[model samples]
Target: MPDADRALPAHPFDDDKLHEECGIFGVVGVQDAANFVALGLHALQHRGQEAGGIVSYDPDVGFNSARRFGYVRDNFTKASLMDSLPGQLAIGHVRYSTSGSKGQTAIRDVQPLFAEFSVGGCAIAHNGNLTNADSLKQELIERGSIFQSSSDTECIIHLMARSIQNNISERIKDALRRVEGAFSVVAMTRSKLIGVRDPRGVRPLMLGKLGDGWVLSSETCALDIIGAEFVREIEPGEMVICTAQGVESFHPFHPIKPRFCIFEYVYFSRPDSVIGGHSVYETRRRIGVELAKENPVEADLVCPVPDSGTPAAIGYSQESGIPYAMGIIRNQYMGRTFIEPTEQIRNMGVRLKLNVNRALIKGKRVILVDDSVVRGTTSRKIKDMILDAGAREVHFRIASPPTMWPCFYGVDTPEKDKLLASTMTEDEMRAHLGVDSLKFVSLDGLYRACGQKGGRDSADPQFCDACFSGDYPVKPTDMIDKGFKVKEPA
Candidate 1:
């Protein structure tokens, strides 16, 4: 991804920026996998603007793939290129890495990776993390296995090859059991489109249908992009197979618990995307309502940071009876804007991709609603921008609770020290942002707003709370830090 739209600071100092996560999409039982993949990926662009790729499968020629580390448009703009990726079944991925995960940062680590064996060919796309991947990869490597990428997903591919089983479903089940993590996988084979969510359902995966098509997408938002009707989400702890023989469903390892990532409602998902029966919009709107109830602020108007902040801002405005306004105009064409690398740009940065509406911010005391504050660099710069824009006062309202921990399930966030909330108290965080007041949604408020904090057997009863609570279902070892080098013997 290009940093032209980036919050580039001329020098390093106090600045502001937020990190982004990636998105996943897939369409099977379709006539043109590439075209559908392109369309679906486009819809998911908001998930990860950094890189994109698609894999098309045809029995006659094997798997045909196209991958680019930039925006989807950068690679899939030509009609002929789409022609090159010919197949009726396809799965694709878009990516954003925070700073750690080596395999995740490399473009090659982008999804829809393919591996072939005597058993058959497999192309898989995944969203979320594998806690045990580092250990699993080390074990596989010790057994003389070679890895092409740093992704945990490669572990799954390698394990499937190692299984040597005749049954594909059994192979997937076996591989899934050995690994502990939060994954929602969409795997494509010569004859089938298989979808599986972790037994805990830490992430979102949905099943959809259009005409004679059976669609397996990371979220229902992709289904809307391809004119597919929303069917129910793939059940947690269950595997759903959509193939020519018809659809089959089974639960071999039921966890009896659900923990979908609360961030999906706060930041990761497109507000239009519905997961586990809760519309992202509804989830966010409820957050706003909850915010109004929890923190009543006196401001002239409720202004969201824009885009992701709009729905929650609207909810806040409606519930608080404050009119909502677009205080900052986003430069949509600002390319793939990334975290501002330095401080000078941070000091003077006023939205490399955002423009403050002087008319909106000039005189009124403004309340700014944003999702979360990462490095505090971006938030500080943005707050300073609002202050410089002539605002009477600036109050920052974060939709979710303070993110004190880094996400391991592939959110691409930076290390713990970089997380502003991780090192500061609410008062300290308030002092850093230079805002008149700083408030974040409480843990209870966030859970209640997202409709994710619920008991067992609830309709949408899955949530990934690993980041907030350090009970990672799986935690990789320091094979990277402690040096798990697979260099051959000299």
Candidate 2:
């Protein structure tokens, strides 16, 4: 079992926001594919900063693998390391450890996990979590399957090894059919690059075209990094096999309604990326617009919480006709290891990343726009900073609905009871944060921002708003077996 206490963020205030899951990218028919994979992973560094790994298949060299701790730019950019991994087919993964031994991530736990079988050598990188992993692991162990790493992704390799299928793709299909929950997988064999999305399509995986080669990435931003042309998103319950000859698509699972993760628009994805034809930046702006309309408060200035909150802050300003100001400036160079050893410096958490613009905040009734409040610690600290800078009042406007439930589909979230929204009402949260006022974009408003004009259909939600609405599309089987109760559908 993962040590939840140890899984806390290295920097104190880092835990104030929901951590991203993982990023998977793969390419075929490209020269020095590992180089491209490294660049793609770099673009996706926001998703997972803990570790990164790449696996490349060369005809002469066979399969080459390299996994490293820290950022991709630091580890994979070395000429010596990149030279070691030479091939035309490659897949890479950047991990934040939603599963396995969190905070104490071992090198083996890093992904693009490779396995050799009767069919051939195949490397697989996975993006989401498996809800039934615990049960599946126990069953596999009883049947004499030895585990390599603590990761749930290793289970897929073992299942594939035991499958009676003749090819890697068929075995993958077989293994996935038995597991439950969200997964956007990218696997590469000797000649083929394969991408698969789970039946629910809870996580993202998209296809891209690069000259004679093909690409599969978690988001379009990575494609843009490698100069790859945007192709369509990989459909739910669909698998695409990419080879030099052509790309082949297959639907190996029973078709179901797609409930893609709605939070991608709110925080997970890069603002510049586009998903399902909607720009993530535009969606966040729309969310801010909705927030401004729903909760119109008279304030002297609209200020963003910095980087993540900027676009929404702009939208809120435009909608409310409140002038936007850079009330908080972010220190982009700050990393997790900066002066974090001492308790006093640890307490000085949010200040290390963000500083209040005293001149702009002073004597102003500031309307602070932030993406979401996970624990309310950072919000409280930011509010205190604004007040200390001479702000008359601070009102918090959150871009997304309250996050009341933990995400089981890959996002690293605090326990149910730890979430501030889970234990407190809106008014309670406002009081807890010590803000003059607090309001969040409603669930219906969020759906409207995502292009659902009629708002979320309660009977059949268009997207997975489980974190906000507590209506999990896929049952968290492992959590349930361990006595974790889910919200009963209304």
Candidate 3:
């Protein structure tokens, strides 16, 4: 997930940043899987806030599902809702519509999508987007395969249902092999709980153990929420099946170097969660340290943009020997501006979300640390707020490199034309935002912060930085020959 922000009414704010894709959780061997799933989804609420759904199966009751277009706490916490879903094996999803397809926002599109086949029934919850979904959907529809929803995830269900494989797990592997792009999926059959990650591992998924039970979730934090001890991440291109007997693993794809999403360190994942064996909070702090070394600034105080930038700001202060101060305070209750639905509402979003502290920033030359700069709307508004607070000078430092390209796998990014960094240099952006100085951490520096000492090696990169560099590992087959603007699936 990029940020813990929501939109207004039915759509999210229209701010110039990325909206998170989704989060998935599944558990087997627990007597109350739905309860554990609810709590796990609550921990992952920051990943996606649009809607939540859970599907569970019991030997007697069969498969049951419940989906609602609201927060997990608001809908999944109710006793009635829980009563409606009873089972020992369960999988759940919290989604943010990544596509513009019609009915994408409808309740029917909310996931943990269920499908019944000759073999048995299965429910799947996906955490990333499939780049070749449209092409696959077209072929499937032409073959007379009817889709239940407009979501790309539904493609997996239909594909699996039509597979010639004998078992459900093999059918799943068969279905996945036909698609391209990122995915971290948790699925459930009548007696088995399954988890799989894309070959590139573009998304994240972890395995954990809770007493005698097993769990799979998008982040380790979800495991913590349910008292599940962290096992290991479900290996990239690996599939794990958990049942009452035990757990088994399979390699569904050919071996290759893994390229986990680098943004997970910059913005996604809870600060408390760990990714690729690195602490998210620590990675953020290291990013700040790297930024300070690469872009030195002499300022009275190091101020953070709030919550998201807090850890980085602390690291910057320590490295630069400057005092850290909370110069900007964010409102806890406001949603992100992107969901404002209107330009007028989005224009007022910054003020509603953050305010400058006159006492801390007054007459001070301050360095403001932020995670990244998307469209530059938030940065510009923040600079104005600092100026109004009587700050003599404002210097902006970004933790990650400029997001030069849009994300096609999952994260909802603005088109290239809408991205500020895509069209402007650092100096131009600084002038545009009315800041005295602006410096973004170098791409290599970002890699170093993620524990890659020699920095990004284009030959064999350690992680996915495609948004910063236009080197997408996946072919983006559905988007090619389209001038970088992949038409959404019809």
**On TM-score, who's better, 1 or 2?**
2
The TM-scores of all predictions, comma-separated, are 0.88, 0.98, 0.94
State which candidate has the highest lDDT. 2
Worst 10 residues of 2 by lDDT: 1-10
Error of 3 at 413 (Å): 0.7
Sort every candidate by lDDT, greatest first.
2, 3, 1
lDDT of 1 by residue, 103-207 (tens): 235555667788876777788877777767877888999998999777778888888888867967778887887887678888888878888988878777888
Q: Give the TM-score of candidate 2.
A: 0.98
Q: Sorted on TM-score, highest at the top, how do the candidates line up? A: 2, 3, 1
TM-score head-to-head 2 vs 3, winner: 2
Candidate 1 global CA lDDT score:
0.74
* Off by more than 4 A, model 3: 1-14, 100-104, 335-347, 485-490
Clash counts for the predictions, in order = 22, 0, 8
In candidate 3, how many Å is residue 480 off? 1.2
What lDDT does the true structure give each of the candidates?
Answer: 0.74, 0.93, 0.87
Best by TM-score: 2
Angstrom error of the Cα, residue 478, model 1: value is 6.1
